[model samples]
Target: MTIEITGSAQWEAWQAKVLPPVERVADGLWSIPVPIPDNPLRYVLVYALECREGLVLVDAGWDDDVSWQALTDGIRTIGAHITDVRAVLVTHHHPDHLGLAGRVREASGAWVALHTLDAAVARPGLSPEERSEDIRSHLELHGIPGDEARRTVDLLDVGRALQSPAPDVLLEDGEEIRLPGLELKTIWTPGHSPGHSCFYQPDRRLLFSGDHVLPRITPQIAVYSQTAGDPLADFLRSLERLETFEVDEVLPAHEYRFGRLDRRLADMTRHHIERLAELRAAARETPGRTAWELSARLAWSRPWESFDATSRRFAMAETIAHLVLLENRGELRRGADRPVRWYPAATI
Candidate 1:
C-alpha cells in the first residue's frame, strides 16, 4: 500500500520502499519493527535493552498478535524473555506505543514509566465530568465542529480500551534511568505532544527519537488539547534542540534507522519553513481566507491519498495550526469568528 502525505512526496516514497527489519546492533539494544497494515507509512520501532537488573523495553508494540509475536520472538533471539522485562519505558502516550504496556507488564512484572504531561491522557480511570470536560475543552480549543467532535470523542474508545493503565512513574528531562547495566537518559522533546520525551544513549550515540524526529517525514505537532497556543513554535524549538545532539543513529518510532542527522534536521527545518511560506503565499493570494479554504487551495496532486473525513479534518487543522503560529509570530494575521476563521499574511 502507498501512503500519501500532502506536502511530502519523497518521504512517502522512502516509506513505500523500506521493509521493517529487526536487527540486534548492540549487546543490549535490539530494534524490532511493527508494520502498520492500514497505512504503509506507519511503522513503529520498539527497542529492547538488556540490563544487569533485567530486560528493559522501550515503547511497547501494537495491540495485535503479529506485533506482539514479533516482539516476543525478537526477545527470545536475544536470550531475553518477556517475563524478564523488569520495566517498560514508554516514549509518549500514543496508542501504538502505549497500547501493550499492561500486557507486557503482566507478562514480565515490569513497572511502566511515562512523562507527566502524557500520564494524564494515559491514565485509565476518569469521572464522567472529567471525561466530558476533557472532550468539550479539547474540541473547542481546536475549533473542531460540534458534530465531528462528538464523533471523534466517541471513537476514542480504542485508546481507552487498549491502552495500559496509568504510568506508575514519571520521566523527567536529564533524568537517567538505569536498567541493570544499560543506562538511558531522558531528553524532553515536546511539540509532537505536550510530554514527548526521547531517550538518548550517549555512549552508543543512539537516540530513540519517538515521534519528535522521524527519518523521512516531519511529525504532526499541533494544538489538540484544551491548552491553546503556538505549538508549531514549540516544535521548531524542539527541532533546534535535537540538532545539537551527536546522533550517529536515530531509532525513530516510525521508519528505518539511518545516519545524516544534521542533514535530516536541516531538511525537516527547511520543510517547515517552506510550508509556512506556502501558507503565506496562499494567504497573500486571497486575504482573510478560511483555513479550510486554504487547505483546499494547497497543492495536492496525489489521487490515491486517503480522502476520508477524518483525514480531511486532520489536514485542515494542521494547516490552521501553522497559520495560527505564523499569525502569532507576526508573519500572518487572522480574522476569527469562533470555528469559522480567516487568516491573512502579515505586512512585512
Candidate 2:
C-alpha cells in the first residue's frame, strides 16, 4: 500500500498565521489548534478524546489568555466544555505542549499526567534564580562564554511562566492509560526531551506523536546538562521504534497528521546520519574546536550570527549532541579543558 500524509487540508493551509478550525479527526477524537506566540510553527494540535466520564486531552496548548480562550471555544464546538476535560496527558514539559495544563486543571479539576522524568522539570518549586543558575551552568559547560550563557539563561526564563502544574499521575513506558472509553498506550521516546512520549491506540492504529515525529520538520534533538545520555543516539533509536508500529495515521502536536510512518522515520534518521557526517568532517578540518565554534561553522536554516539567544543555544546543544555521538563512535575525541573541546580521532 502506498503511504500518504493525511490531515485536514484547511489545517495544513494555515500553517503559521491564522488558527485552524477545531476538527473532528476520528470517531471520538477532535483536533483543536491553539496558537503559540511569536513561534514559526504557529500552533499546537490539542487532541481531545471523548470518554465515558468526560474528555481526555492529549496535550494542552501554550499557556496564555488567548490560548485558553481558543481551547475553551474549541471544546465548545465539540459539544463539550473545558470543564468537561477530565485529564491532560502531557507529552513533555515543553511550554507549547504543557503550558496550559495547569490552568486546565484549575478550571476542570483535571488530573495532569506526564512521564516521571519530565514531571520533575514541570513541577513548580524552583526559584527563578535557581532555574537561571541551572541554565547558566549547563550552557557554560557546553563551551558557551559566561556572559552569553547568562544572557541565554535570561531568554529561557521567559518559558518558566508556562511551566505546567505538578503532575498528578506519572506515566511509565508501555503502560496503557486506564481511560474509561479509550485504549491508549504510552511509548517512551526520549530524544526531544528525556521523557517525551507518544500515545498509540493499537485498536485504531493511530499514534499521537508529540514532537517525537513531525510531518515536515525534523524535531530538534539536542544535548543539555540535564540530558541523561547521548540524545542523538536516543533520537535515532526512537525513530527506529516507529517502524514497529503499524500506524494508519499520525497526529502530531505541531504539524498536520500524516501516514507513511516508515518513510518519515527514514527521512529523520537520514537527516541525523548526514548531520553526524557533516560534524565529523568539520571536526577533521578544525582539529580542536568547541561545540559552540563548530556550530557557527555549520549550516543552519538562518545564518549563525542572525540567530537569537534561544536559537543559538539550541543550535549549540544540537552541535554538542552530534559531537558526543561522533566521539562515542570513535570518530572524535574530547580534549581536557575547562570548556571541553572536540578533536578528530584521526588527526588530519
Candidate 3:
C-alpha cells in the first residue's frame, strides 16, 4: 500500500499569519524558518545540524537585511550564533537557497559547498556586456522577439547581482561528508537545475530533498541554454531513483516537512506525465507552432499575458522542455526555420 504524507501540524498552523516556530527536529538538529519577501511560500526552512565544532546549515535563505536578521535570530533561538556556523551545504544555485551563503561565509568564515556542475555556472566570470549578449542570443533562439528578449535580459541583472561567491568545497554524488557527528551523503538529483541535490542520512531515515520532491508543488523543470538536454526526462529518472530509498521524514527547503517519500515521488512523476501529454496534444492541435505560442495555449495558474517577464521566460523554457522530450520520443518534429517551429511527427 502506498502511504500518504500529511505535512507538519506546526507548519500548517503558521501558514496563515505567522512564521513557523523554530524547533529541534532531532538530536542536535534544529529547523529555522527564514522569511522571503513578496513570495507566497513565505519562508525557507534552514536546517542547522549541530556538531562538535558548531552548526552546519543545509541551505541559506535570501540575502537581505530582513532574511539575515531572521536567520541569525532563529539560530539564536537554538542556542547558537550565526558566526558559529562551520559549513553550508547548498542544495542548488537558486537565489532563495544560495543568496545568503556569501553573507554567512563573511560572518562565520564557513565553507560553502556545492556540486561541481553548479559551482561552475554559479557565477559565470563574464563582463556585464558579454553576459547581456549571451542572454539576448539565448532568448532569441527560443523564439522571443529581440526587444522583449532584451527586456528579459535586463531583468536578469538583479539575479546576477545576488549570486553568492564560488563554492569553497565541490561535492560529488554519493560522497559522504565527514562532519563531526553527521553522516550526510550527497545524492545528485539533477534536472531542477543541472546539479540539484538531496542529502540523505540513512541511519535517521531522513532526506533533505532540496526542490527535487516537494510535498505540494512540483519543482519546475525547464530547459535553458545552460540546462542539460531533456531536463524533464532527467527529472523523471531522478524521481524514480528516490523511490528506492526508505525515508521516514522529508526536510524540504520550502514548505513543511512530511513523510511517505514513495507516495510523494509517485505524485510528482504522474504530474509530469500528464503535463507531457498536454504539451503533445497542444503540438498536434496547433501544427507548426513555436514553443512560445504552444505554451500560451496550455493551462497555467494565470493567463499567459498576466505573467511578468521572468515568469514568461520560465514558462517558455518549460514549454521547450516538453517539446524536446516529445521530439526525442518521435511524437514531434522540429522545423528548420529561424525561430524554429514544432510539428507533430508523422505516424509510422
Candidate 4:
C-alpha cells in the first residue's frame, strides 16, 4: 500500500513530522490525532466509536498535558467531550498507548480495558525495585557491558518512561468488547508486547491494528525480562493468524490507515524471514558472538552507532528475540557463557 490510500490529508503532514487534523473515518467512527511528545511516532490515532450511551475510544494517547489537551480537543472536534467517553480500549501496556487511560477513566468515569496479560504487567503491582531488577537482568542477560548496562538501566526508567496505569477491565484473547452498538472483538497478537491486541469489527470489516501492522514501519518485536523466550516465533504465528480476518480497511495506531491486509502480513513475515537468514549467516561466519555484538551488526533503520542508550537496549532485545527464534529453529545454538553467545547449530 502507498500514501495514496492513506484516506486523509495526512501524507504531507506525516512526512513533515506534524500532527494531522482529526477526521471522520466513517458515519459512526472518528479518528483523533493526539500528539506524542519527542517520539519519532509524532501521534497516535485514537479512534472514537459512536454508541447509544456515549462514545467508546479505541486507544488513549500519551499521558501528558499536551497529549491530553490534543486528545480532549480532538474529541471536541467530533462534537463530544472526554467526559462523554464510555470506555477506553487499550491495545497494549506501552506507556504511549496505555498512559492516558487512567486519566481518561478519571475524567470520564470510563472503564479502561486491556488484555489480561498486559494488564498484569501495566498494573501498579510491581515494586520499583522489582522493575529495576528486571531491567538489570534483561540487560545483563543480553551481554550489555558493566558501565553501559548500568547507564541503560538508569535510562530505562527516565528515557523509555514506563508509567502504564492499571486498567479497569481485563480481557482475554478472542473475547468480544462488551460495548453497546459496537461489535469489536479483541484479537490477541503478542510479540511487540506479551499481550498486544488488535480490535476487529466483523460487520464493518475493519481492523484496528494497534502496532500489530503498520503502513510503513514494522513494530519493534523486542524481548525483555517481562517478555522472555522466543518472541519472534510468537510474532510470526500471530501474523499468520491475522491473515484469516476478512479486512476491508486497516486503522493502525501510528502512521496512516490502509487496506490489503494479506499483502502487508506477507511482507512483514518476509522481512522477519530475511532477518533470521541474515542472523543465521552471521552466526555461521563469526562462530560465537554475544547478543550485543550480533545486535550492533544487524541492520536497523538507523546506524547502530547513532543509537542512544534506550535504543541500544531495545535493539539488543529484538536481536535476542531473533537469536532465540533461530535457536528454537535449530539454526543456531547458544553457548553457555557468562553473557551467552550464539554459534551455528550444525557447528555446535
Could you tell me the TM-score of candidate 1?
Answer: 0.83
Candidate 2, 1-348: lDDT as tens digits: 233768856445655457777889989899998888888888899999999999999999888899889999999999999999999999998988988998999999999999998887566476677667877887887678999998888776544642556789999999889878878999999889888999999999999999999888889899876676788888899888889989999999986888989888988888898988888888888877888889999988879989988899989989998988888898899888767888887763
Instruction: For model 1, name the residue pairs that clash.
Output: 52-180, 52-181, 53-180
Assess the local accuracy of residue 236 in candidate 1 as a C-alpha lDDT between 0 and 100. 83
List TM-scores for all candidates, in order. 0.83, 0.94, 0.93, 0.95
Return the clash pairs for model 3, or none. none
Which is the leading candidate under TM-score? 4
lDDT of each: 0.72, 0.86, 0.85, 0.85
Instruction: Supply every candidate's count of residue pairs whose N, Cα or C atoms clash at under 3 angstroms.
Output: 3, 0, 0, 0
- lDDT per residue for candidate 3 within 35-54, as digits (tens), equals 98887768888999998899
Model 4 local distance difference test score: 0.85
TM-score, prediction 3: 0.93
Tens digits of per-residue lDDT, candidate 4, 71-146, equal: 9999999899999999999998888898898899999999999998887767545667777877787688768987
Reference-based lDDT, residue 43, model 4: 91
C-alpha lDDT of residue 66 in model 3: 99
Q: Candidate 3's C-alpha lDDT?
A: 0.85
Give the Cα-based TM-score of candidate 4 against the true structure. 0.95
- Please tell me which predicted candidate would have the highest lDDT against the true structure: 2
Arrange candidates, best TM-score first: 4, 2, 3, 1
Q: Write the per-residue lDDT of candidate 1 for residues 1-348, one digit (tens) a residue.
A: 122222133234355776445677677778766655456565577888888777888899667777678778878877778898889889888777887787898887899999988886565476555675576555644455677666766655443543456788898888898765788899888777778899999898988888888866688766544435677887788889988888777777876666667777778878889888888888888775666567776754343144555565567667867887887877777654555455554443
**Model 1, C-alpha of 55: deviation from truth (Å):** 1.2
